[model samples]
Target: MSEQLAEERASARPIPGQVGGRAVMLIPRRDPGTDESMLPPDYQRIIAAVRQAAGPVMAREVGEGVGVDVSVKAKLEPLRGKLVRLVDRGWLQKLPDGRFTTRL
Candidate 1:
C-alpha cells in the first residue's frame, strides 16, 4: 500500500513553478487577469520591488530589495537573469538604458 501511494505521488503532475521535479526560477508570462500570487515567492518579491521603485531601476538596486548580495557579480547575475526573464514575460519592462520598470 505504501509503495503504491509513493508511486502515485511520484507520477502526479508537477506543481506550478516546477518542471520535471525541478523548481523553475523564472516567472511565467502574465495571463490576462492573473495576479502576482500566481508567481513564486521570490518572483513576487522581484515584481514588488520594481513596482515600488520611484522610477526605472538597475538590477543591482532590485537585488537590494530582494535580499541578494548586490556587490557580488555572480550573485547579481542570477538576479539580473530573473529581471530579464520578468521583462520577457511582460511583468516588467526593460528601458533602453537597461534599467527595469513595472509594466503597469
Candidate 2:
C-alpha cells in the first residue's frame, strides 16, 4: 500500500456506534451554512453574554469577559476572529455603532 493511503487509513476509525457513518472524516469548511447553522459552544457563550449585557457589546468586552487576553498585539489572536466569524455566520449581529448583539 502507498504510504499516504496507509497513513490516512490509520488515522480513521469508526465511532463507538456509528459503523454506518462515513469512512473518511471531513474537515468543516471555513464558511459553511452561515444562515441556518448552530453556533459552536464558545460562540454560544459569547452570545449569551451579549444577551445579558445592558445593550450591544464590543468585541473586546465579550472577548475579555470570555477569558481571552485580547492584547491588540497578542502573538496569537483568536477571540476577535471568532467574534468576527460569529457575525459573518449570523450567530451575532454587528451594530453600526460597532457592537455585537444576538441576532433577532
Candidate 3:
C-alpha cells in the first residue's frame, strides 16, 4: 500500500469483531433500512451529530458535537476523513461549499 493510504488507515478508529481475527468495516455504507447500531460508536455519533444539525456543518462543528477537541487542527483531520468517507458511502452529503448534511 502507498504510504499515505497506510497512514490514513492507521488513523481511523478500529472496527470491532474481526473476520477470523481480521478487522472488517464497521462503518459500511448506509443502505435503505440499515440500522444505526451496525456502525461503530464513533461513526454513529458523527451521524447523529450531523442529523441533528439545522443545516450543513463543518468538520469542526461535528468534532464539537461528538466531544472531540476541536481546538487542535490535527485532531480534526480524522473526523473530517470519516465525514468524507460517509459522504462517499451514501451516509451523508457534502455540499458545494464543503459543509456536510444528512443525505436523507
RMSD of each: 8.5, 12.5, 11.0
What TM-score, computed on C-alpha atoms, does each candidate reach? 0.76, 0.55, 0.74
Predicted candidate 2 versus true structure: per-residue lDDT over 35-81, tens digit per residue = 22234456567777788888888877786677766676472256666
Candidate 1: residue pairs that collide: none
TM-score of 1: 0.76
Instruction: Report the C-alpha displacement of residue 5, candidate 2, in angstroms.
Output: 35
| Model 1: residues with Cα > 4 Å off, grouped in runs | 1-26
TM-score top scorer: 1
In angstroms, give how far residue 59 of model 2 lies from its true place: 1.2
Model 3 spans > 4 angstroms off: 1-24
Q: Write the per-residue lDDT of candidate 1 for residues 1-104, one digit (tens) a residue.
A: 97787665445432457679987654556756556766777888998998888999999999998899988899999889888887888888999999999876
Tell me the tens digit of each residue's lDDT in model 3 across 1-104.
67776565445553566778887565666655565666677888999999988989999999999999999999999899999988898888999999999886
RMSD score of candidate 1 (Å): 8.5
Clashes (backbone N, CA, C under 3 Å), per candidate, total 0, 0, 0
- At residue 74, candidate 1 shows an lDDT of 96
Ranking the candidates on TM-score from highest down gives 1, 3, 2
Q: Between the candidate structures 1 and 3, which one is better when assessed by lDDT?
A: 3
Best candidate (score: lDDT): 3
